[model samples]
Target: MALLNDIDGLQKPDNHYILVLYPGAETYESLKNALAPLISDLIILKKRGFNQIGGYYWSVELYFSSDWKFLAICLGMKSANTLHFCPWCDCSKNEMNTTSKKINKSMDNIKVNYHKINGHTKEPLFHMILLHNWMFDELHILLRITDRLWELMLSDLRRENVNEEIWKEKILLEMKQLKISFQFWYKRNSNNLLHTSLMGPDKLKILRELDLTAIFQSRT
Candidate 1:
């Protein structure tokens, strides 16, 4: 599914437009073909301003936004776990922790170099938009960060020899108190505990209201 939103406009349901809607695997070739018509229209829109019925002209400034995985796929970049993982900059896996780096990548540079440059596996599907104009989904970033924090919390509980069932129950109880639906269960084939996949709002509640000290109090 591809959605187009007017950023400058009010946050309303009508402001969002669905460009493409289909069910299929999201691959480079698939996305390139799926978005071909949209891209073609965007190129023309960017070059020539769209004229309105009442003597008004709207100049389009295109921006592409998606989750990191989809963004990587669209940009024809390697997965985040790869050596040259970042789509925005030349930063490799080792340098990801560094903050003070120059923004050296541009759409022109990426187009010229294509697969030969900074983590790019092929030409970007949305080459009409500038590289800087490509935005990351904020919800995904929050979800991923909270996921890591949840993992670390679980590791800490395990390290302290906390009973799995007890901790799981405690977590579920806490989630219930916070009005967030969460659970822990084991698959038939796997010993690992799998929990409910929380959405952005639920994850935010967990991050803000989850009482870690209470969860660890019995161990201490």
Candidate 2:
């Protein structure tokens, strides 16, 4: 909390800024305990002579994870993968395995249904949204899919009656070409960091351009 005292001088009054706190699993309990008191002080400061409006620290914004299902559970969110997760909205994901069909048939609702409890428990806590990590969702998965595609290409090349040494050279060249393509796409319009920071709208736009129903022909 004391560290934030220095922050006031650096930014203008109306400018909005996020203060992200990343407390690991084990320290989460302690961090929560400490943050409560600090926020209370900030609220008090706002009420006093200080002009620091503390609304930003008062509420949670977003949560990130590789596994949406597990993150949903931790945040007391009903699976986004299910239709029943939204209470007010009347929409659902189509059961068809085809991604394109599902996108077309479904209305794509963003509302989240919070879990409620009565009996022994007092209150229910839930996150507003669960975001996928950039590394896991984009880079890692794309690399894996590309690797599988390259293996398939190599298998096709193997069936040729060319010499084994020449075939190996062809595989190396193919690998280099694939790597170059991935690099170009990764750094599409900007540097690595900016490219990886692609948000939901951009990702969805790219997906809409793909042949979502196309099945991979490679077994390797």
Strongest candidate by TM-score: 1
In candidate 1, what residue range of length 10 has the lowest lDDT sum?
A: 1-10
Summarize candidate 1's per-residue lDDT along 178-211 as a digit string, tens digits. Answer: 9887877789898776778888888898888889
TM-score of each: 0.87, 0.30
Q: Rate the local accuracy (lDDT) of all candidates.
A: 0.81, 0.36
Superposed model 2: Cα runs more than 4 Å off: 1-60, 63-97, 100-136, 173-220
Q: Indicate the residue-level lDDT of 93 in model 2.
A: 52
Indicate the worst ten consecutive residues by lDDT in candidate 2.
Answer: 117-126
Q: What's the C-alpha lDDT at position 141 in model 2?
A: 49
lDDT of 2 by residue, 1-220 (tens): 1232347753555453544365555232444454455545544544453434764343322323334333333333456546543222233455334343222111112222222211111111222232221112354445455555545654564565555445444433433543322111235686332112333443344344432222122222
| RMSD, one per candidate, in order | 2.8, 13.3
Model 1 TM: 0.87
